[model samples]
Target: MHTEIQSMHLRASQKQLTLHTGVYYTGMDDEAHTFCTVSDSLQHSPSAIWAYLTPVLDRIKAEVSDVDTINFYSDGPATQYRQKGNFYLFNKEMADRNMKQATWNFHETSHGIGVPDGVGGSLKRTENMSVLHGKDITTATDFVKTVKTPDSKIRIFQVTEEDVKSKIIEKLKLQPIPGTMKIHQILSVKRGELWYRDLSYNSMEVHEHQGQHLKFFSFWKVIMLYSICSLH
Candidate 1:
Protein backbone atom coordinates (compact mmCIF):
# COMPACT_ATOMS: atom_id res chain seq x y z
CA MET A 1 0.00 0.00 0.00
CA HIS A 2 1.25 3.51 -0.78
CA THR A 3 0.18 7.09 -1.49
CA GLU A 4 0.83 9.57 -4.27
CA ILE A 5 -0.04 13.23 -4.65
CA GLN A 6 -0.39 15.21 -7.83
CA SER A 7 -1.45 18.75 -8.67
CA MET A 8 -4.16 19.20 -11.25
CA HIS A 9 -5.47 22.37 -12.84
CA LEU A 10 -9.12 23.21 -13.45
CA ARG A 11 -10.61 26.10 -15.29
CA ALA A 12 -14.00 27.78 -15.62
CA SER A 13 -14.32 30.82 -17.84
CA GLN A 14 -11.03 32.65 -17.30
CA LYS A 15 -10.33 31.52 -13.72
CA GLN A 16 -7.98 28.65 -12.97
CA LEU A 17 -7.66 26.75 -9.71
CA THR A 18 -5.29 24.09 -8.36
CA LEU A 19 -6.49 20.76 -7.06
CA HIS A 20 -4.15 18.70 -4.89
CA THR A 21 -5.05 15.09 -5.55
CA GLY A 22 -4.02 12.01 -3.60
CA VAL A 23 -4.50 8.37 -4.52
CA TYR A 24 -4.17 5.53 -1.99
CA TYR A 25 -4.02 1.91 -3.00
CA THR A 26 -2.70 -1.52 -2.17
CA GLY A 27 -1.98 -3.90 -5.03
CA MET A 28 -3.81 -6.72 -3.28
CA ASP A 29 -7.10 -4.86 -3.30
CA ASP A 30 -9.27 -4.44 -6.33
CA GLU A 31 -10.55 -1.02 -5.35
CA ALA A 32 -8.57 2.21 -4.94
CA HIS A 33 -9.73 5.61 -3.68
CA THR A 34 -8.85 9.15 -4.70
CA PHE A 35 -8.90 12.30 -2.53
CA CYS A 36 -8.80 15.83 -3.88
CA THR A 37 -8.33 19.21 -2.20
CA VAL A 38 -8.81 22.51 -3.92
CA SER A 39 -6.22 25.16 -3.23
CA ASP A 40 -5.61 28.63 -4.62
CA SER A 41 -1.87 28.05 -4.34
CA LEU A 42 0.27 25.25 -5.77
CA GLN A 43 2.39 24.66 -2.67
CA HIS A 44 2.82 20.94 -1.87
CA SER A 45 4.95 20.94 1.27
CA PRO A 46 5.16 18.12 3.86
CA SER A 47 2.51 19.64 6.13
CA ALA A 48 0.18 20.34 3.24
CA ILE A 49 0.50 16.79 1.95
CA TRP A 50 -0.10 15.33 5.40
CA ALA A 51 -3.17 17.53 5.85
CA TYR A 52 -4.69 16.12 2.67
CA LEU A 53 -3.80 12.59 3.78
CA THR A 54 -5.37 12.77 7.24
CA PRO A 55 -8.96 12.12 6.20
CA VAL A 56 -8.00 9.66 3.54
CA LEU A 57 -6.05 7.64 6.08
CA ASP A 58 -8.96 7.68 8.49
CA ARG A 59 -11.24 6.33 5.81
CA ILE A 60 -8.69 3.65 5.01
CA LYS A 61 -8.32 2.66 8.66
CA ALA A 62 -12.06 2.28 8.96
CA GLU A 63 -12.29 0.18 5.82
CA VAL A 64 -9.34 -2.05 6.71
CA SER A 65 -9.71 -2.56 10.40
CA ASP A 66 -8.44 -6.10 10.32
CA VAL A 67 -5.13 -5.22 8.76
CA ASP A 68 -2.53 -4.86 11.48
CA THR A 69 0.31 -3.50 9.42
CA ILE A 70 0.06 -0.80 6.77
CA ASN A 71 2.88 -0.26 4.29
CA PHE A 72 3.24 2.79 2.07
CA TYR A 73 5.05 3.05 -1.25
CA SER A 74 5.91 6.61 -2.24
CA ASP A 75 8.23 8.41 -4.59
CA GLY A 76 11.54 9.81 -3.34
CA PRO A 77 10.44 13.33 -2.58
CA ALA A 78 12.17 14.65 0.55
CA THR A 79 9.85 17.62 1.04
CA GLN A 80 6.67 15.62 0.69
CA TYR A 81 6.54 12.11 2.16
CA ARG A 82 10.16 11.30 3.05
CA GLN A 83 10.97 14.10 5.47
CA LYS A 84 11.13 13.95 9.27
CA GLY A 85 7.97 15.98 9.85
CA ASN A 86 5.90 13.57 7.84
CA PHE A 87 7.58 10.60 9.51
CA TYR A 88 6.85 11.91 13.00
CA LEU A 89 3.24 12.58 12.18
CA PHE A 90 2.82 9.18 10.59
CA ASN A 91 4.43 7.44 13.57
CA LYS A 92 2.00 9.08 15.95
CA GLU A 93 -0.96 8.16 13.76
CA MET A 94 0.20 4.55 13.58
CA ALA A 95 0.27 4.37 17.35
CA ASP A 96 -3.14 6.01 17.67
CA ARG A 97 -4.61 3.62 15.10
CA ASN A 98 -3.09 0.63 16.93
CA MET A 99 -1.27 -0.54 13.88
CA LYS A 100 1.36 -3.22 14.61
CA GLN A 101 3.81 -1.83 12.09
CA ALA A 102 4.14 0.75 9.33
CA THR A 103 6.69 0.72 6.55
CA TRP A 104 7.38 3.28 3.85
CA ASN A 105 9.23 2.14 0.71
CA PHE A 106 10.43 4.83 -1.61
CA HIS A 107 10.86 3.97 -5.25
CA GLU A 108 14.02 4.80 -7.16
CA THR A 109 14.08 8.17 -8.79
CA SER A 110 12.07 8.26 -12.06
CA HIS A 111 10.84 4.69 -11.50
CA GLY A 112 7.77 5.06 -9.33
CA ILE A 113 5.09 3.79 -11.67
CA GLY A 114 2.30 1.97 -9.84
CA VAL A 115 -1.43 1.87 -9.09
CA PRO A 116 -1.57 5.48 -7.82
CA ASP A 117 -0.14 6.76 -11.07
CA GLY A 118 -2.95 5.09 -13.00
CA VAL A 119 -5.55 6.47 -10.60
CA GLY A 120 -4.18 10.00 -10.92
CA GLY A 121 -4.15 9.74 -14.71
CA SER A 122 -7.71 8.47 -14.79
CA LEU A 123 -8.86 11.29 -12.53
CA LYS A 124 -7.24 14.00 -14.64
CA ARG A 125 -8.59 12.39 -17.79
CA THR A 126 -12.12 12.27 -16.43
CA GLU A 127 -11.91 15.88 -15.28
CA ASN A 128 -10.50 16.99 -18.59
CA MET A 129 -13.28 15.28 -20.51
CA SER A 130 -15.90 16.83 -18.25
CA VAL A 131 -14.38 20.26 -18.70
CA LEU A 132 -14.40 19.76 -22.48
CA HIS A 133 -18.13 19.00 -22.26
CA GLY A 134 -18.65 22.38 -20.48
CA LYS A 135 -18.73 21.28 -16.88
CA ASP A 136 -18.27 24.11 -14.39
CA ILE A 137 -15.28 23.40 -12.13
CA THR A 138 -14.28 26.79 -10.89
CA THR A 139 -14.00 25.74 -7.24
CA ALA A 140 -12.94 22.62 -5.37
CA THR A 141 -16.52 21.94 -4.35
CA ASP A 142 -17.62 22.29 -7.93
CA PHE A 143 -14.92 19.91 -9.07
CA VAL A 144 -15.95 17.33 -6.51
CA LYS A 145 -19.59 17.53 -7.59
CA THR A 146 -18.68 17.37 -11.25
CA VAL A 147 -16.53 14.23 -10.94
CA LYS A 148 -18.34 12.22 -8.30
CA THR A 149 -20.79 9.71 -9.69
CA PRO A 150 -23.10 7.33 -7.84
CA ASP A 151 -21.10 4.32 -9.06
CA SER A 152 -17.68 5.91 -8.77
CA LYS A 153 -15.23 4.23 -6.39
CA ILE A 154 -13.09 7.36 -6.01
CA ARG A 155 -13.84 9.20 -2.77
CA ILE A 156 -13.12 12.92 -3.12
CA PHE A 157 -12.37 15.45 -0.35
CA GLN A 158 -12.13 19.22 -0.56
CA VAL A 159 -9.55 20.43 1.99
CA THR A 160 -9.48 24.11 2.85
CA GLU A 161 -6.57 26.31 4.00
CA GLU A 162 -7.91 26.21 7.53
CA ASP A 163 -7.95 22.41 7.45
CA VAL A 164 -4.25 22.29 6.57
CA LYS A 165 -3.33 24.71 9.35
CA SER A 166 -5.30 22.80 11.96
CA LYS A 167 -3.70 19.43 11.18
CA ILE A 168 -0.08 20.41 11.93
CA ILE A 169 1.66 18.24 14.57
CA GLU A 170 3.93 20.67 16.43
CA LYS A 171 5.24 18.42 19.16
CA LEU A 172 7.17 15.86 17.13
CA LYS A 173 10.62 16.83 15.85
CA LEU A 174 12.76 14.39 13.77
CA GLN A 175 16.54 14.45 13.55
CA PRO A 176 18.41 13.21 10.49
CA ILE A 177 20.56 10.07 10.45
CA PRO A 178 24.15 10.74 9.46
CA GLY A 179 25.54 9.29 6.18
CA THR A 180 22.09 8.49 4.92
CA MET A 181 20.10 10.01 2.13
CA LYS A 182 16.60 11.15 2.96
CA ILE A 183 15.31 8.97 0.13
CA HIS A 184 15.89 5.40 1.15
CA GLN A 185 14.45 2.24 -0.35
CA ILE A 186 12.77 1.04 2.83
CA LEU A 187 11.93 2.83 6.06
CA SER A 188 10.12 0.74 8.65
CA VAL A 189 8.97 2.55 11.77
CA LYS A 190 7.17 0.53 14.38
CA ARG A 191 6.05 1.82 17.78
CA GLY A 192 9.56 2.40 19.14
CA GLU A 193 11.87 0.99 16.47
CA LEU A 194 13.01 2.40 13.13
CA TRP A 195 14.83 0.49 10.41
CA TYR A 196 16.13 1.59 7.04
CA ARG A 197 17.75 -0.12 4.06
CA ASP A 198 19.17 0.90 0.76
CA LEU A 199 17.52 0.35 -2.61
CA SER A 200 18.99 -3.14 -2.83
CA TYR A 201 17.15 -4.10 0.35
CA ASN A 202 20.37 -5.42 1.83
CA SER A 203 22.30 -4.07 4.81
CA MET A 204 19.86 -2.38 7.17
CA GLU A 205 20.32 -0.05 10.13
CA VAL A 206 17.95 0.07 13.06
CA HIS A 207 17.33 2.78 15.65
CA GLU A 208 15.15 3.35 18.66
CA HIS A 209 12.75 6.27 18.78
CA GLN A 210 13.18 7.96 22.15
CA GLY A 211 10.23 10.06 23.08
CA GLN A 212 9.77 12.69 20.36
CA HIS A 213 13.05 11.92 18.55
CA LEU A 214 15.10 9.00 17.35
CA LYS A 215 18.29 7.91 19.16
CA PHE A 216 20.98 8.88 16.66
CA PHE A 217 23.77 7.16 18.62
CA SER A 218 22.13 3.76 18.04
CA PHE A 219 22.35 4.32 14.31
CA TRP A 220 25.95 5.50 14.63
CA LYS A 221 26.83 2.32 16.50
CA VAL A 222 25.28 0.20 13.74
CA ILE A 223 27.35 2.04 11.15
CA MET A 224 30.55 1.51 13.17
CA LEU A 225 29.84 -2.19 13.60
CA TYR A 226 29.24 -2.60 9.89
CA SER A 227 32.43 -0.76 9.09
CA ILE A 228 34.44 -3.00 11.46
CA CYS A 229 32.93 -6.15 9.96
CA SER A 230 33.84 -4.99 6.45
CA LEU A 231 37.44 -4.39 7.49
CA HIS A 232 37.70 -7.90 8.99
Candidate 2:
Protein backbone atom coordinates (compact mmCIF):
# COMPACT_ATOMS: atom_id res chain seq x y z
CA MET A 1 0.00 0.00 0.00
CA HIS A 2 0.97 3.65 -0.34
CA THR A 3 2.91 5.17 2.53
CA GLU A 4 0.45 5.87 5.32
CA ILE A 5 0.91 9.32 6.73
CA GLN A 6 -0.01 10.79 10.08
CA SER A 7 -3.24 12.79 10.44
CA MET A 8 -4.93 10.92 7.63
CA HIS A 9 -7.88 13.29 7.69
CA LEU A 10 -7.96 15.59 4.73
CA ARG A 11 -8.33 18.77 6.77
CA ALA A 12 -5.47 18.02 9.12
CA SER A 13 -1.84 18.71 8.30
CA GLN A 14 -0.10 15.48 7.37
CA LYS A 15 3.35 14.14 8.13
CA GLN A 16 4.76 11.37 5.97
CA LEU A 17 4.98 8.03 7.72
CA THR A 18 5.64 4.75 6.00
CA LEU A 19 3.71 1.56 6.41
CA HIS A 20 5.41 -1.41 4.81
CA THR A 21 3.21 -4.46 4.42
CA GLY A 22 4.05 -8.04 3.56
CA VAL A 23 1.72 -11.02 3.18
CA TYR A 24 3.43 -14.26 4.13
CA TYR A 25 2.30 -17.72 3.16
CA THR A 26 3.83 -20.85 4.65
CA GLY A 27 1.78 -23.45 2.69
CA MET A 28 1.41 -25.58 5.80
CA ASP A 29 -2.01 -24.12 6.57
CA ASP A 30 -4.70 -21.96 5.04
CA GLU A 31 -3.85 -19.09 7.37
CA ALA A 32 -2.20 -16.01 5.86
CA HIS A 33 0.00 -13.57 7.79
CA THR A 34 -0.18 -9.85 7.15
CA PHE A 35 2.81 -8.02 8.58
CA CYS A 36 2.78 -4.25 8.80
CA THR A 37 5.89 -2.31 9.77
CA VAL A 38 5.38 1.32 10.63
CA SER A 39 8.21 3.81 10.74
CA ASP A 40 8.51 7.54 11.35
CA SER A 41 11.49 7.84 9.07
CA LEU A 42 10.69 9.00 5.55
CA GLN A 43 13.49 6.94 4.04
CA HIS A 44 12.61 4.09 1.75
CA SER A 45 16.20 2.94 1.36
CA PRO A 46 17.59 -0.55 1.81
CA SER A 47 18.57 0.13 5.42
CA ALA A 48 15.05 1.31 6.09
CA ILE A 49 13.70 -1.77 4.39
CA TRP A 50 15.82 -3.92 6.69
CA ALA A 51 14.63 -1.99 9.71
CA TYR A 52 11.09 -2.86 8.68
CA LEU A 53 11.73 -6.44 7.61
CA THR A 54 13.91 -7.61 10.48
CA PRO A 55 11.07 -7.69 12.97
CA VAL A 56 8.67 -9.27 10.49
CA LEU A 57 11.19 -12.02 9.80
CA ASP A 58 11.69 -12.59 13.49
CA ARG A 59 7.98 -13.13 13.99
CA ILE A 60 7.82 -15.40 10.96
CA LYS A 61 10.74 -17.51 12.18
CA ALA A 62 9.30 -17.84 15.63
CA GLU A 63 6.07 -19.26 14.24
CA VAL A 64 7.46 -21.24 11.31
CA SER A 65 10.44 -22.99 12.82
CA ASP A 66 10.79 -25.72 10.20
CA VAL A 67 11.02 -23.52 7.11
CA ASP A 68 14.44 -22.95 5.58
CA THR A 69 14.14 -21.25 2.20
CA ILE A 70 12.25 -18.04 1.42
CA ASN A 71 10.94 -16.62 -1.83
CA PHE A 72 10.08 -12.93 -2.15
CA TYR A 73 7.71 -11.53 -4.75
CA SER A 74 7.40 -7.80 -5.37
CA ASP A 75 7.34 -5.10 -7.99
CA GLY A 76 10.85 -3.82 -8.64
CA PRO A 77 11.52 -0.32 -7.40
CA ALA A 78 15.24 0.55 -7.54
CA THR A 79 15.58 2.74 -4.46
CA GLN A 80 13.50 0.52 -2.24
CA TYR A 81 13.92 -3.13 -3.11
CA ARG A 82 15.82 -3.61 -6.37
CA GLN A 83 19.23 -2.02 -5.77
CA LYS A 84 22.64 -3.47 -4.95
CA GLY A 85 22.20 -2.64 -1.30
CA ASN A 86 19.06 -4.74 -1.16
CA PHE A 87 20.85 -7.58 -2.91
CA TYR A 88 23.64 -7.42 -0.36
CA LEU A 89 21.16 -7.42 2.48
CA PHE A 90 19.22 -10.28 0.93
CA ASN A 91 22.26 -12.52 0.96
CA LYS A 92 23.67 -11.39 4.29
CA GLU A 93 20.41 -11.34 6.19
CA MET A 94 19.35 -14.79 4.99
CA ALA A 95 22.69 -16.24 6.02
CA ASP A 96 22.52 -14.38 9.31
CA ARG A 97 19.09 -15.88 9.91
CA ASN A 98 20.33 -19.40 8.98
CA MET A 99 18.11 -19.75 5.96
CA LYS A 100 19.21 -22.36 3.43
CA GLN A 101 18.38 -20.60 0.15
CA ALA A 102 16.23 -17.80 -1.18
CA THR A 103 14.92 -16.21 -4.34
CA TRP A 104 13.55 -12.72 -5.01
CA ASN A 105 11.25 -12.48 -8.01
CA PHE A 106 10.23 -9.17 -9.53
CA HIS A 107 7.02 -8.72 -11.43
CA GLU A 108 6.23 -6.06 -13.95
CA THR A 109 3.60 -3.46 -13.06
CA SER A 110 0.62 -5.09 -14.73
CA HIS A 111 1.31 -8.48 -13.17
CA GLY A 112 2.20 -7.38 -9.64
CA ILE A 113 -1.24 -7.46 -8.03
CA GLY A 114 -1.35 -9.82 -5.05
CA VAL A 115 -2.65 -10.28 -1.52
CA PRO A 116 -0.33 -7.73 0.00
CA ASP A 117 -2.11 -4.99 -1.88
CA GLY A 118 -5.41 -6.02 -0.40
CA VAL A 119 -3.89 -6.10 3.06
CA GLY A 120 -2.69 -2.55 2.66
CA GLY A 121 -6.00 -1.30 1.31
CA SER A 122 -7.89 -2.88 4.17
CA LEU A 123 -5.60 -1.37 6.77
CA LYS A 124 -5.74 2.00 5.13
CA ARG A 125 -9.51 1.89 5.34
CA THR A 126 -9.23 0.83 8.96
CA GLU A 127 -7.03 3.79 9.73
CA ASN A 128 -9.36 6.11 7.89
CA MET A 129 -12.33 4.80 9.82
CA SER A 130 -10.48 5.27 13.08
CA VAL A 131 -9.74 8.88 12.20
CA LEU A 132 -13.34 9.42 11.19
CA HIS A 133 -14.46 8.15 14.54
CA GLY A 134 -12.35 10.78 16.30
CA LYS A 135 -9.59 8.39 17.27
CA ASP A 136 -6.27 10.16 17.62
CA ILE A 137 -3.37 8.73 15.57
CA THR A 138 -0.74 11.42 15.35
CA THR A 139 2.32 9.21 15.10
CA ALA A 140 3.49 5.82 13.93
CA THR A 141 3.10 4.51 17.45
CA ASP A 142 -0.44 5.75 17.64
CA PHE A 143 -1.24 4.21 14.31
CA VAL A 144 0.09 0.86 15.46
CA LYS A 145 -1.93 0.87 18.67
CA THR A 146 -5.08 2.05 16.92
CA VAL A 147 -5.20 -0.79 14.40
CA LYS A 148 -4.09 -3.58 16.69
CA THR A 149 -7.00 -5.64 17.91
CA PRO A 150 -6.88 -8.96 19.69
CA ASP A 151 -8.73 -10.76 16.92
CA SER A 152 -7.13 -8.87 14.06
CA LYS A 153 -5.13 -10.86 11.53
CA ILE A 154 -2.72 -8.04 10.86
CA ARG A 155 0.51 -8.17 12.89
CA ILE A 156 2.12 -4.81 13.59
CA PHE A 157 5.77 -3.93 14.21
CA GLN A 158 7.27 -0.53 14.90
CA VAL A 159 10.58 0.74 13.54
CA THR A 160 11.85 3.56 15.68
CA GLU A 161 14.17 6.49 14.91
CA GLU A 162 16.82 4.69 16.91
CA ASP A 163 16.49 1.69 14.62
CA VAL A 164 17.18 3.90 11.62
CA LYS A 165 20.14 5.58 13.26
CA SER A 166 21.67 2.27 14.33
CA LYS A 167 21.58 0.86 10.78
CA ILE A 168 24.80 2.75 9.85
CA ILE A 169 23.45 3.29 6.35
CA GLU A 170 26.42 5.39 5.26
CA LYS A 171 28.94 2.64 6.03
CA LEU A 172 27.23 -0.18 4.13
CA LYS A 173 29.80 0.15 1.27
CA LEU A 174 27.31 -0.82 -1.42
CA GLN A 175 28.33 -0.86 -5.07
CA PRO A 176 25.84 -0.95 -7.89
CA ILE A 177 25.41 -4.27 -9.67
CA PRO A 178 25.45 -4.22 -13.47
CA GLY A 179 22.20 -4.58 -15.38
CA THR A 180 20.31 -4.27 -12.13
CA MET A 181 17.23 -2.94 -13.89
CA LYS A 182 17.06 -5.89 -16.25
CA ILE A 183 17.39 -8.41 -13.45
CA HIS A 184 14.03 -9.89 -12.52
CA GLN A 185 15.22 -12.73 -10.37
CA ILE A 186 18.00 -13.07 -7.76
CA LEU A 187 18.84 -16.41 -6.18
CA SER A 188 21.16 -17.12 -3.29
CA VAL A 189 22.08 -20.65 -2.30
CA LYS A 190 24.98 -19.85 0.00
CA ARG A 191 26.34 -17.02 2.11
CA GLY A 192 27.80 -14.07 0.17
CA GLU A 193 26.74 -15.54 -3.18
CA LEU A 194 23.95 -14.60 -5.60
CA TRP A 195 22.81 -15.61 -9.08
CA TYR A 196 20.78 -13.10 -11.03
CA ARG A 197 19.07 -13.21 -14.41
CA ASP A 198 16.95 -10.97 -16.55
CA LEU A 199 14.34 -13.66 -16.80
CA SER A 200 13.47 -16.69 -14.74
CA TYR A 201 14.00 -19.93 -16.58
CA ASN A 202 15.22 -23.27 -15.43
CA SER A 203 17.12 -24.15 -18.59
CA MET A 204 18.90 -20.80 -18.86
CA GLU A 205 22.70 -20.81 -18.92
CA VAL A 206 24.62 -19.20 -16.04
CA HIS A 207 28.14 -17.80 -15.69
CA GLU A 208 30.68 -17.37 -12.86
CA HIS A 209 33.49 -14.90 -12.05
CA GLN A 210 36.83 -15.19 -10.28
CA GLY A 211 39.32 -13.07 -8.31
CA GLN A 212 38.38 -10.75 -5.44
CA HIS A 213 36.56 -11.08 -2.12
CA LEU A 214 33.32 -9.64 -0.82
CA LYS A 215 31.97 -8.98 2.64
CA PHE A 216 28.75 -11.01 2.52
CA PHE A 217 29.21 -13.08 -0.63
CA SER A 218 32.56 -14.41 -1.69
CA PHE A 219 31.34 -13.99 -5.28
CA TRP A 220 28.39 -12.82 -7.32
CA LYS A 221 27.18 -14.66 -10.44
CA VAL A 222 25.06 -13.83 -13.40
CA ILE A 223 23.99 -15.77 -16.46
CA MET A 224 27.51 -15.61 -17.89
CA LEU A 225 30.17 -15.38 -15.12
CA TYR A 226 30.54 -14.81 -11.42
CA SER A 227 32.21 -11.56 -10.40
CA ILE A 228 33.83 -10.69 -7.11
CA CYS A 229 33.30 -7.54 -5.08
CA SER A 230 33.93 -6.53 -1.50
CA LEU A 231 31.67 -4.99 1.14
CA HIS A 232 31.78 -4.67 4.90
Top-TM-score structure, candidate number: 2
Candidates in order have lDDT scores of: 0.60, 0.75
User: What are the per-residue Cα lDDT tens digits for candidate 1 across 158-211?
Assistant: 677777776565443346544345445433445434555444333234423322
Q: How well is each residue in 75-188 modelled by candidate 2, as lDDT tens digits? A: 999888888878888888898888877888888758856787887888889988987777867689888888889988999899997786665446544556667787777877
Q: Model 1 residue 20 lDDT?
A: 56
Residue 231 of model 2 has an lDDT of 23
How much does each candidate deviate from the true structure in C-alpha RMSD?
10.8, 7.0
Clashing pairs in 1: 2-73
